[model samples]
Target: MESPNNKRKRVKPILRCSTNEQSERSPDDQLAIIKAMADARDWEVLDPIRLEGRSGSLHATMDWAVEQVIAANRAGEDIDDAIVYDQSRMGRTGGFAFGTHKQQLAAAGIGFISVDCPIEGPHADFIQFANAEAARAQAISIAASSARSSQISLERGLRGHSTQAPYGLDRLYLNAQGEELFIIRKLADGTSLRLDPRTGAELERYPKGVRAYRKGGLETATLCIGSEEHRQVVIRIYRLRHEHGWRGVRIARELNDAGIPSPRGRHWTKDTVDGILMNEVYLGFAYARRYTDAIYFRHQDKAPERLEGPGGRKVRGYRPREDWFRVEYPKLTEYLPSKLRDAAARWQAAYWDRYEDGHVRSPERGQKRLHALSGILIEETTGQPMSATQSGTRANPKTYYLLPGSHQYSSQESFLRRRIPSAPLYRAIIDEIEMLVCDDDGLRDILRTEILKAEAERRAGDGEAESLRARYEKLGRKMESQIDLLGEDDDDVMRRKVEQTKAQRRAVMERLAEIDQGPRLTADQTDELVEQLIEALQSELAAFAAAGRPAFRKLTEMLIASAVADLRSGTVSIEFAVPASMIQHRFMGMDRPCEPKWRTHTHKWKSLPLAAITVELPERCDMDCWEPFEPKGCDDCRRQRRTA
Candidate 1:
């Protein structure tokens, strides 16, 4: 014990880890190991350091000690040596067990010693390697067990939560007051309440003694003049967009024009309108989870990055709506009327299905050429017309042709195939028209006849009837003005206006009839005759359907067929027709319809030789009953009959 020259050497601070072992050793094991330190005397004075472990178990103690040793080494400390009560105290096997303890000691420039093996260093190769392997295996086992526990919790809908709270809901936990802060509850007065720590308020209790207090809804409630009124407005908006065929932007504009106030009392923008339309709360249900959260790991920022979920790996980052939590928030949106709610639900479903199946297209991105051609095609057989399937609304695009399984055309594929290769038929019609119109004078005559017959009439002895004539003429002017306002080529609007004008004209004619005298050439009689003549002329002009005048049904059929064929083969052809007005304006050679004229001799007896007929009778055909093309059922057959 010694040479005076070996004067007391300075002792380094040391750290140690102790873990569970099969064998039980007491303080003697620790005390003996401590004695192996470089400055043995200092071991007597060094206080025992303890670290908190998982439990009060020995394994936990060792886990803590390992952490301490690793930390000390990182801080550049140089403890001379670490003492372990036994091999298992540090780890399981000799190699891995001692290997871990020795690695820690070596990292801190300290040597390791076991009480029973005083001559050995913790840094010895065998011990260091063994300890490392054992410690790694323990860590892996713990991880696997933790994962299994998490999986079980998920299956049970329990959560590890990691102290994380869902949005609009607080993480429930016992605080200093030992009270459940997030549990739903009914107070003594039977009011629902939730603990809001930020405001230091016990909000209205919920049924489950747990609830996430909603700030927006609460604020809306406070500001809402009447919840029913606000809910009615929301219902109206939803119905108009989802049920009534109004777009979100148009709905917003309509609401603003009607002086309706939005929930925020600001001008409604398209985005705001879209938000309202897309909101599920109005149906008395809504998923509290947001797409932003599902896609992005966090949602603190206004714009967050999209996160690809484990499930999203197969199909990009979209999560099915069914998978989202459908929380029933009883009050937030309960005010919506049942009928409106049902309608909105149906519309949303249809639109969602369309979106999912790639049936919807966007105009902003510019539609494909085929889509544009499809829009112009109308189905001749059915009254319905085709829309461009490739562009426009993302939810309900204008489709060129109806789907194959559609009730309107169950055999759509066959119908399209039969129609697509009708180029020869179309060419024949074109050839016939081209040859028929070869003589310009004959063509002009046809046009003149149609135009003149469409004009109104007048007769002699109608002098006293001028007042009624003027009234009729005034009505005609109004009708023309309305037609002009409606513009051209917009069938829906034009058809509506035409119906309205016809009703008004019918009333006028009825009034005229009531004032008419017997067929004695009286002033009233003459005016009545003139009006009847004009009406007859209109009927006759429509009946003399020329070969070049397009058959409305055939045109429609061709358009629909062309679109469907394009969809199958991915080929498209476009034809542009300049509007008559544009053509007239751009070129001065065309003749405009003459201003309405009122005359006696000029109107009644003048024949302008306006048309000529060179009928091509199909050889050996029965002129009395023969018809072209297969009957597309009754309505089309009736139209052909009337025109013939």
Candidate 2:
């Protein structure tokens, strides 16, 4: 029998590639080279760990591979060595970090080895340190070169290397001869428009979530006016700020209600709106180098020589305004007039003054009241959630749940056009619940129908689940076969094919996992679940009269999934949270039940007439009630408000 110490040493190989650059050797090539070296030394190589598109400067990036080797050594599996394709792959953070990581492996009784730069004997430490310093120098050189190129591009009146265009702007690519190649229009809906450069004709419209075409070699990009629709929207945003003095949040709300998609193809937010308002790009100026590189590696070390500014404070990374590179684009000037731009600037300054003087307060400030239907309430027209807002003084507050932009319609005569009073709406919803509980036969019939429907849907999905399982297995085998075909002389094409197969296998695995996790039930189980839910609901109802607001809120959270308000139809549709089929399974497992798959029941509430509500206005106002007040009131009212 062979002696234990004489047996081939078991080693763990680590392979890494910092970027997807074609010139850089791939992790697969590195692994293959490391394995060949291991075989030559008669070493038993364990499954290699691969990391791609990860920076070598960050020790945290290699922590997963390091921990595994250390763990195996501690568990008596005896990982004799931790080997890497090259010393730079260990780290590019100079001698200190590299040496520290090596020491950590040594402490764990695992020897560190680099296939490319194998150092041994007394000079090993010095040689390793030199190699690490070289890597650090190379990293710094590359960063400095990139920064220089960007500065040169800016100086030449180009837009630098940034590919992203702000909202209401398009990137026009120009060839070396200064002839327009194509215009890339990135819209607020996460879609791109490819236009003919000269005629501005629509060449193609890419679907949402598809990335826009990148500029090629010998091509430069400049900002230009985007689509007419987007330009009008931008003008309206400035108009709303300058003429109406509307805040960013209110503007975002208005845009959302009008079915205008926000930048990034998502709902409008306060930050997104404010960013557009503050951007100088719309004012015919493109600014770069507005922020310092405080987060850059050179500044991260906190070395005295590398730090900028006084007192060693970073000033939150904002560079001086004078230091910023400002280039004027005549094309952008036509997008927004100078008059509107100046008016917007003045309005912004005055708004800040009002905020500092305590005349303006955010809607969420100092409000502690809990809204029972806050998240669950939805506006049917937009399918957007209703947000809670309060008016009046702190002592006598009146809360309402309404579509965010509907505040502009507060003075409308129709009840549905305005806000929904929280107290009255909550009362109406509880009344509906009580009526349902009182009729046992009706509730039972509804529950039975919902359970049967769920069973039928589940039965129909069985075939699909089986098909997914078979597909997942096939993908798994395909990936394994491709991986086995990989060799020392394999080309880039074969390697890419293997990677694609791996990605497909991962997608199929995720789908199979989702299907397997869904709750499964039979016909017998469904009836028992329905009865259990009715009993629970009845118990909840018995205590409803005496239940506090907190108790009632909790009950609603558990029982109601969502409530949609149809303003035009004057109806509120409700979907219960715990479907009759899922109640027993959820209750037993303590899992949160999924939303009901059946159609929701609609309930109509009595509308509180606008004429009934009296309003008290200032003495300067001639209006008897709020109903007659236009969104923009008369000149006298405006002057009076300004004077106050």
TM-score of 1: 0.23
Off by over 4 Å in 2: 1-91, 101-128, 160-163, 185-195, 199-220, 227-271, 294-316, 336-340, 347-644
The lDDT of each candidate is 0.39, 0.62
- Give lDDT tens digits, candidate 2, residues 472-586: 7897888788778778576577789987976676565544433323345545555666677677666776665445455666556556655777666555666554433235333
For candidate 1, the per-residue lDDT at 432 reads 32
* Cα misplacement distance, residue 82 of candidate 1 (Å): 94
For all predicted structures, in order, the TM-scores are: 0.23, 0.40
Report the poorest 10 consecutive residues by lDDT, candidate 2.
Answer: 601-610
lDDT of 1 by residue, 421-525 (tens): 233223333333333233334434453443334232322235535676577677788788777767567868877877687567655554453332322233443
